[model samples]
Every structure is written in structure tokens, then in C-alpha cells.
Target chain A: MITFKNVTKEYPPKTHALAGVSFRIEAGEFVSITGQSGSGKSTVAKMIFAEEMPTSGHIHIGDWDISNIRHSDIPVLRRQIGVVFQDFKLLPKKTAFENVAFALEVAGESTKRIREVVPHVLKIVGLGEKGGRYPRQLSGGEQQRVSIARALVHRPKIIVADEPTGNLDAITAREIIELFTRINDFGTTVVLVTHDRDIVNGLHRRVITLRDGKVSSDAEKGKYLLS
Target chain B: MRSFFRIIRFALQSMMRNFWLSFVTVSVFVLTLVTVNAVIVLNVLANASVKSVEGRVQVTVYFTSDASESTVKNVQSYLLGLSQVKDVSYVTADEALAQFKENHQNDPVILASLDEVDGNPLGQALKIRAYNAGDFPFVLQALETPEYKPFIKDKNYNNYESALRVLSDFSEKVRLGFLILALFFGFIATLIVFNTIRVAIYVHRDEIGIMKLVGANDWFVRGPFLFESICYAFIATVVMGVLLSAFLTFANPAIVAFFQGVDVDLVSYYLTNALPMFGAQFGILALLGLGTTTFAMRRYLRV
Candidate 1:
């Protein structure tokens, strides 16, 4: 579960990215955070990961208060919440499998565990046959799937997907969204932050819309709305 | 145990993937360590030679020709009593003439000249050896004390004193000069190694960024590079040590013959007493390998 209590993030010179934004994401729920560029959707994701601390508010994931967490402990927080970026940040030199295994390796996972878990995640992303291929060898959609596989290695309780299909074609983006839906069906919570109206309308999940750094709408089985 | 192996496997894979960058990094480490090792060996050899020469230099106090045998013996006994004097051997004029004849036996002109010195013209002298080279000058100074002043005549004292002073001063200067030269090379080596590592890091900036983004721990990311550097330095050290030892062991005789009139055989003398050189080289290699890598890593890899 994730909770934002009056979270305010302000850059210097008084530019408020998130002004007293408050919300809660319950466990095992698939929810979309819809906002245009610079509307502070990514800021919300960053705050959840503690990449940027809230300027004047309490942010909680489960029972942990991450607003005051030290930089060294950020990785521990990251392990619990899988994050997918707009750009699939895979190590180019590594095979798709190596890119996924790297996530487990950094966490000091046993080779046996990495060997077992990596293929399972790749299979879920439908790249089980392409594990040996490097990132450059894979399609853009396939690369994003590899990143998703990497994020799933820890069996994280929540996935924070920021524009998961931003760079993909409409069909490929639909496939990625369908993959998210499948992952959520397996009892993991998914928080998708995107401006893709068609995907949001297609999902028919709970949606939270942001307008000018504030939550504009919170609807169950919501349609995409620009505020 | 398994986790550690995993880390190692990951590191090895990463290193292999970034081959050229790793090679550049390790080569820098090797070059720095080699320079450091050479300087250290040279410093050790210089110090050891100076100490050997200093230890061997004996002050020969010649007595007056008119001095009685009993009086010369008293003077020798007095010189032996000094605490600074390690050993004193009294060589009579007859013994000196015999020693001179034996030394010049190969040279007929010198042998004839030595035979012409009719009735043992050399005086009875006391040859004094000191414990340490540094103690030689102190022993010379102690000879001029009131207690031994009467025994030390001006007959041969001035020349011996100046010679001793020159040798001691030269040894001190050589020691200081080697130290300065070693430090200069050390600085240059460090800078070269630092720049090479920096350049390598610059070349692999993307890989490093990828590693960081993927959540590699600082040690996990740094360990392979550090190990590579240490391996390079260690191999270079072994190679340099073997080459130096072989050169000293095999080339010594030829070098001694070349400098036939010199007191020290540049090679054999160093090889014979080379424990310090080994210690110095090993120490320099470790310092260079560890110090330069640690420094370069801190500056470049902030994490």
C-alpha cells in the first residue's frame, strides 16, 4: 500500500511540482495516474521511490515512512517497488537475461535463485526465447518487456510503471498494457502513470487524474479525463 | 559463499564485456607499479652500497718513524679502548712492507720500488674499523678527544680525516639524492596512473552509468577493476624482480671486470645483499597498486 499525505515538492525559486498532493494506493490494486507532461505524474512516482524527497509532507509505503529515509536505504525501498521508465534502461552490452540477472546480482542473490527466477520472468514477458539476445538485437517493445522482467525479479508488491508504452506503437503499447493487466491479475498492485487516453479507457480500472500539480479526479472504473 | 561467487561472476562478465577499458586501467596500474618498483630497488641498492662502503672504511693512524715499538703498542691499546672503535689492528712497519710487496707483486715497477724502500720506511699504524658507516666520523672525532689526542699525530691524520669526511659526505648526498629522485618518479607515476584511469572511466562512462542505474553496489562494481589493477601490478613486479635478479646474478662478473679498479662491483655487491631491495620493491608495488586505484576511484566513481 502507498499513501501520500499532503505531499508538497517544490524546486528552488518557488516552483511547486506537487502542491499538497494526497492520495492512497491500496495493495493488489491496478490504478492509473493520468496527467499531461509536467503535470507532476512522474514527480509522484519519484516521490514514491524516494528519488526526490517531499519538501513538506509525509509519504508512506506500507508502514515505512520514506520522506526521511537516508540515501543508502533508497535501494531497499526500490526493491519493494518495481519501477519501469519511459526509456527501457537496459545495459546495452548485456544479453536480455544478463540485464534481468543484474537486478538480482546487485541484491546479492544466489546464482541458483537468479538462474531460476530470470527465465520465469522472461517467460512472463514473452521473451523467454530471446534471453540470449542483447538489447540492440531486440525490438523496442521487447526491450521494454525485458525491463519489466528485470523489475519483476524481486517479486515486488507494487509496480510503478511511468509511461510503460510511451515509445511503442499502438498495438505494442496495448500488448504492454495487457501484460500489466496480466501481472496485476497475479495479485500484484500496479500504478501506471501515463497520458495515453486510449489505454486508460481500455483498462477500465480506478484512475486518479492530476491537473496543475493537484489531483483533479479520482474515479472507479474511470475514463481518461484531461483537467 | 554462493553470493560471493555470483558477485565475482558478474564482475568477470562485466570486465570482459568492457575489455578495452579494463585493459587500459590495468596497464596504467602496471606502468605505475613498475616505476615505483624500479625507484625502490635503486634506493635500496644505493643505501646498501653506501652502508657497505661506510662499514668497510678503516681509519689508519700512522705513528712517527722515531716512535718506539712499546709506545706504538700503547697507542694502539689506547685506540682500542675507545667505545666508538669496533676493532683495532696494529700493523708493524715490517708487516706493512710485506703487505705492500704482496699487493704490487703483479706490477714489476711497483715491486722494484717497494724493494728499494730499504729498511721498512712505513711506520707502525693502527687500523680502526667502526660498527656502522655512520659511526665512522664519530670515531674519527672521538680520536681527537683529550684522552686519545696524544696518540693521534698530525703525520697522517689530516689526509685520513679529509678523506673520511669526503666519503661520508658523498654517501649522505647519494642517499638524499636517491630519495629525492625516487619521490619525483613516484609523483610522476601517480599522475600518469591517475590520468589513465580517469581516461578509461571517461571512455566507459555509459557502462558505469548503466551499472549504477541497475543498482550495483559500490564494492560490487569496483571489485573487478581493483582486482585487475592488483593483478597487473603483481605480474609487473614479478617480471621486474626476475629481470633485475637475473641481470645482477649473471652480469655481475662482467660488470666487475669492466670497473676493475672500483671498490664495489655494482652488480654482485647489490645481489649479495638484496633483502632490502626485495622489501622495497614489494612495498612500492603494493602502495602504487592500492594507492593510485583508490585515489582514481574516489575521484571518478563517487558512489
Candidate 2:
């Protein structure tokens, strides 16, 4: 349920982060946007979340145009799409439970709803037993799971994981990829942006490859096609 | 309403988690109030002492011995007519001599000199009190009229002028010095508060960024820090009030004894204006904290 038509984003002094890109995904489609570093893959995820605006062209998530979204309206858009960063951006002081509950709390959810939903979501990401632990006390995989749990807390229709497995060990990375697959099987649209080839070939879903600020390929049931 | 309570709860939890920083912020606030209250107490003591000295100042006007008692009484009446002259007393030559003897009774040289004068060398004198120490010069000028100056031998205005000048100058200098001290301490307090909030924002920068990513509005992120600052201000004010009350209770007796006869009742002054005074302090400090928090957040709090 997201569309980027003829989208071009440029930085100052002739730096093109993204150029002449067009993509569309129907509701409940899992898509992988893959490329080498600086190939504008992360820029796609940033556009979906309205962190970076398209310099030219149109972007529509369902019927809402976010090509030039207002700063005030960004929060409402963000609530509908959960974002998972590579570094597991959890508040260091907050416990695992508080960290997950924070997303609902920020949305003005009632204490009763927050109490009911936070544990359930954390349990979905397999962090229910370690809810009392802080980020420092948890391992990298556990911390990443906490991030995934936070992203799922609001039941956002689309989950955008930007390099979600970048810091984890190989086995842990595989587990996180499988977790994304599980999330996708539940009919939530998942856009995984990464450079990891094994994860991309393993998924065998819709893959959009970018090279030098342009989309080089888009293939259904695609393999890791980049050198 | 629930979000408002949540913000307050988050502020308290943050305060407890960063207890040392909170303690430092509150202590700086208390120290600033200490400087302010010290200035207030010193101002009160200086004013009372200056007024006591001013009350004792009187100008003595000596009339020639040949001047009649009626003439001296007439001069006294004229001096009393001036608004500058608060009171005037006419001392006959005999009374002046008796006062001189009583004052110099401990000094034989003064007694021998008085006896050698043969018949009350002292003349009738007018002791003039002015409403203000600064008005003595005006009062002395008023006495130089032809009718009054012909009978007058001398006026001891010079002695009171130098003393009043010193007292006035000292009082003004003390007040100026204290004001400068207050300003210096106030600047330090501002910087300390600015840095404290900056560090707090730095520590929570990640959380702040993530909160925005997770759909929090700007006020949602800002409210907790603002409340945290107010919490520090509130606690600091309560601590300062307790300390000041305890100090006045323990030190009031010593202060009274030190001034001896001068009226220095700090307890009554503080007790009377305690609410408005400390309340103003808390307001000022809380505003400072809030202002600094807002500024410090400008760079870090994007949401």
C-alpha cells in the first residue's frame, strides 16, 4: 500500500541520493530493497518514514501523499509504520518492558491498554521473560529483538527494518531474518532494507536492487543479483 | 489528563535515575537563594545601623555670652519654624556650664579650665535636630540670617557633616558591593543550570530520537524535561526555606546581642514576608531552569 512515482532526492551541490525511482507495493506484500553502501537503499526506508523528503516527484502511502509531508503530520504517519534501526535504538535507562510500552505511551494510550499490550507484543518477539532487563543487560540479539518488539507494539500496518541485522552474529542474523518472514506471513507489509546477500537470497521474495542512485532491477521471486 | 500525569511520573523517574545530576541542580538553586537572602539580611542590618547613627546627630549653636536669654529663645523659635529643624532646645549659659562640668568630671584638666574661666565662659547654645542627616547643611545655612548670626559665636556643623558623609558613603558602598556579588553569583547559577540540562539532554538523546521515530509529538518529549526542572526548583525552594528558618531560630539571639541596643529583628521580618519572598525565589529559579532547559533542548530535541 505504498507508492513512490518518479521520486528523486538530491542533497546540496549536485549530490543525488536517489534519482528517477518508481515502485509500488500492494497491501500485505513483503519487499526487500537491497543495494551496496551509498546505493540509496536506506534513503528508500527514510522516505517511507518521512525522515527525508523527496526533492521531486510524488510519494503516496495508500491515499495519503507524503512527498512533501508537513513536519507536524510526520508523527501521525510514523505511528502507522513501525521502524527498526540497525543499532537497536532503545533507551538505555528504560527496562525492556518500559521501552516497549514507551511507543504506546507516546501515542497517549491508556495505562490499562499499555499494560495489556506491551507484554503481549514483547512476548511475540520472545522478550516477555526479560522484560525487566535494561538494554545493557541484554545481548545484541536480545536487544535487537527488543527493538523488533517495540516496532510491533503499535501494530503498524507496515514494518520497515533498516539494516536490522547489521550488528548481530550470523546465526542471530538468520534468526532475525526468519522473524521478519514470520511477521510478513501474518499479512503485515514488511520492507527490509539491507546489503546482506544471504538474507536476500534466503527470502526469495520481491527484491528491488539499486546501483549509483538508480533502481537497477526489480524482480519477483528474486535472488541476490548484485555482485 | 492521563498523559499529563504520565509526564509528571516520567519526570520523577528520570530524576531518581539521574539522582546526582538532580542533586547538583537543586544545590546550585539553593546556593543562589542563599546569596540572595544574605543580601536581604545585610540590607536590613545596614539600614537599622544607619538610622541609629542618624538619630544621634545634632548640631550645637553657641551664642555670645552677652546675648540675652530672650534673644536665644527668639532664635530657637525661628529655627523651629523651618521644616528642616525637627526640634530645638535652648540651653542657658548656667545650664551649659553645669552640663560641661558633669561631662568632664572624670578629667581634671577640663574641670581646671572651666574653673579658670571665672564666670561661665560657656554661652547659651541651641541644639538643632534635622529631619535628615543630609539636611544639616541646609539647616545651618538657614541659621546665618542677620538677626541670628550676630548673636551666634560658632556652630559645630563640621563635626556632624564628616560623620554623616562617612555613614552615607559606607552604607551605599556596602549595598553596591552586595548587589555586584548577587549578580556574579546569579550568572554562575545560570551557567551551571544550562550545562546541567545540556548534559541531561545529551544522556537522553537516543531516547529522544527514538521517541520521535515512534510517533511522539514535540511536547511529549519536552514535557518531562520541563517538569524535571520544576521538580528541582521546587525541592530546592523547600530546602532553602527550612534552612533559613532554622538559621534564624538559632542565630536570632546572637544577632540581637551583637547589635546590643540597635533593633535587628530578622525573625520578624522573615516571618512576616516568608510566603511572598520565598515564593518569588522559587518562581525565579523555576523560570531560569525552564528557560535553560528549553534552550538546551533546541539542538537535541527534534520531536
**In terms of TM-score, which candidate is strongest?**
2
Question: How does model 2 do on interface RMSD, in angstroms?
Answer: 0.8
The CAPRI classification for model 1 reads as acceptable
Lowest-scoring 10 consecutive residues by lDDT in candidate 1 chain A?
A: A70-79
- Model 1 stretches astray by more than 4 angstroms: B1-164, B188-243, B246-303
DockQ of each: 0.37, 0.72
Model 2 chain A: lowest-lDDT 10 consecutive positions: A62-71
Q: Point to the candidate with the largest lDDT.
A: 2
The lDDT per prediction is 0.75, 0.88
Give the lowest summed-lDDT range of ten residues in model 2 chain B: B156-165
Report how far off residue B175 is in candidate 2 (Å): 2.3
lDDT of 2: 0.88
Model 2: per-residue Cα lDDT over B1-303, one tens digit each: 877988898788878878898888888888888878888888888888777777778899999988999999998898899988899988888888898889889999989977787788999999998888788889889878888889999997635667667867886787777778767766777787778777777877787788889998878889999998898889988999999999999999999999878889999999899999988988998898889888878866566
Q: Please provide, for model 2 over A1-227, each residue's C-alpha lDDT reduced to its tens digit, 9 standing for 90 to 100.
A: 89989999999999999999998988898899999999999999999998889999899987679986787888888999999989999988789999999999988999999989988988888888999999999999999999999999889999999999999998999999888889988988999999999999989899999998898999998878888
TM-score of each model's chain B: 0.60, 0.84
Clashing pairs in 1: none
